[model samples]
Target: MKSKFFIKGVISILLIFLSMYLIDVFVTIPNNVSIKVNEIKYSFKGKIIEKFAVRNTEPTHLKVLIKYDSIITISPNPDLVDVAAVGDSLYKPANENYIFLSSNGNIKKFFYTKLSYETRSNKNFPREWRNKWLDSSMWDSSKEIN
Candidate 1:
């Protein structure tokens, strides 16, 4: 009887640890929201951006500028893309300022804005700029704002 009780206690401890680990893995940190805008349907590739988390407890702020031209069309709409608007925003642009939130709710992912502008230019921009814009810390992989 004594041995049985000890075994049961050990098993219970193991179960508790397992449960905690699972919770940590499944629980989302509520970092940031991501949205993707695709002009072509069913295309896996499209413009994306991640926005920082916006909650009563924590707020993320962003300011962006996009150069406009006769050939440009900002898709999705920056005004509509805000944590205040719908917790997250995503859109596709024919030609416009692309904005979105970062996944970690951090400002690092803001590089997407630079990327959009670089794409507009015929001249090749520095590789470092692209790297800076695409860096995971700078931007979220899951978020996409066209």
Candidate 2:
């Protein structure tokens, strides 16, 4: 009876460890990547000096080098990258989730929605995608981060 109980306890411990490892691999890592990318904030106005693609990443990102030597990585969506020129002026307001690009008096707004979608669809991403709950107005109440 004692040996049987000991074996049962060992099996339970192994099962618990396996479950934790699976959760960390499938749930934690993917959500962390999405959260980290969304946390990047921008508040500046400058002209784009150069543009290039960042390879080796799970999802290819476009690196936009702007005036004052500032670089920002954005999603490589054609609507955002194809329309932007080297000399275009880029404006991203403080505390906002989008940027405005102007070229030859034509202005276009590029939101981070594509970034969210790409990250969620990456091969390393999990089947269960997490929502951005913090963006809700309920989280922005005065009782919160005022």
Candidate 3:
């Protein structure tokens, strides 16, 4: 009778540990992505798991299910741009920022209109705005722009 009770206790303990391990595995969070523009840095945190649902195709583009506060923008390696609003997928850029989507369902290149001298002359221009403009200029020069 004592032996039976000991065996049952051991089994119960094992089961408890196994349950905890499984929960940890399933609930693990993904690494966050941080982007800094000028002096301001923004961070987006959540899980981005890639599971093979279909046997043939490549992971159906990794599912980036994120739970973030405010607006979150994700730029995946190579060129996958996703914008999330209130923890939900809002927009996925068909092309990069420089390549705008036209009403005709075609991609169009956007030329950078020169910034006026007055605008650049603003001594109190916010650092964030300046950084955004610089990033835009860099993107325009890159091959991925179009």
Candidate 4:
């Protein structure tokens, strides 16, 4: 009886580890696009994880801090600082000062930003793809950001 219980405990531990690995595989939201904020472009395809945390809300301004790993290459990485409301899985803007590019696609260039300006002098960018999420107006009732 004692041997059987010990063996079962070991099997349960292995199963727990295996399930954790599978969750990592499935829970990751794919971020495979190059986004251009102002003129400089930054791409985080298979790079940083896209977990944004919203904080410090005022009547006119809001702050968004995107959680990601240490960015070693992507210089001047844009933080989600001081913007209007940004919903998940949609370009759902809270006010007129913001826009959301679809989490899909390979390229998103921000031609306008009301918050902070990019001080980088470089004009080079990754190849621009057709903005597929430009007309995404329908919000999914089942999915939400908050």
> Best candidate per TM-score, number?
2
Model 1 lDDT per residue over 8-42, tens place: 99999999999988885666322211122122111
- Across residues 3-69, which tens digit of lDDT does each residue of candidate 4 receive? 9999999999999999988986666422311133331222222222233434464232222223344
* Model 4 misplaced stretches (Cα beyond 4 Å): 30-54, 57-146
lDDT of 3 at 43: 27
In order, candidate lDDTs are 0.34, 0.58, 0.36, 0.33
lDDT of 3 at 45: 34
lDDT of 3: 0.36
Please provide the root mean square deviation of candidate 2 (C-alpha atoms, Å).
9.4
Local accuracy of candidate 2 as per-residue lDDT tens digits, 11-100: 999999999999987777663555434433446677766666667534334456666676776553445666777778877665455668
Clashes in predicted model 3: 0
* TM-scores vs. true structure, each candidate: 0.28, 0.51, 0.24, 0.27
Q: Please list the residue runs of candidate 2 whose C-alpha ends up more than 4 Å from where it truly belongs after superposition.
A: 1-29, 33-40, 56-61, 65-67, 76-78, 115-146
Best by lDDT: 2
Rank list by TM-score = 2, 1, 4, 3
- What's the count of clashing pairs in each model shown? 15, 0, 0, 0
Cα misplacement distance, residue 56 of candidate 1 (Å): 14
Flag regions of model 1 displaced more than 4 Å: 29-132, 135-146
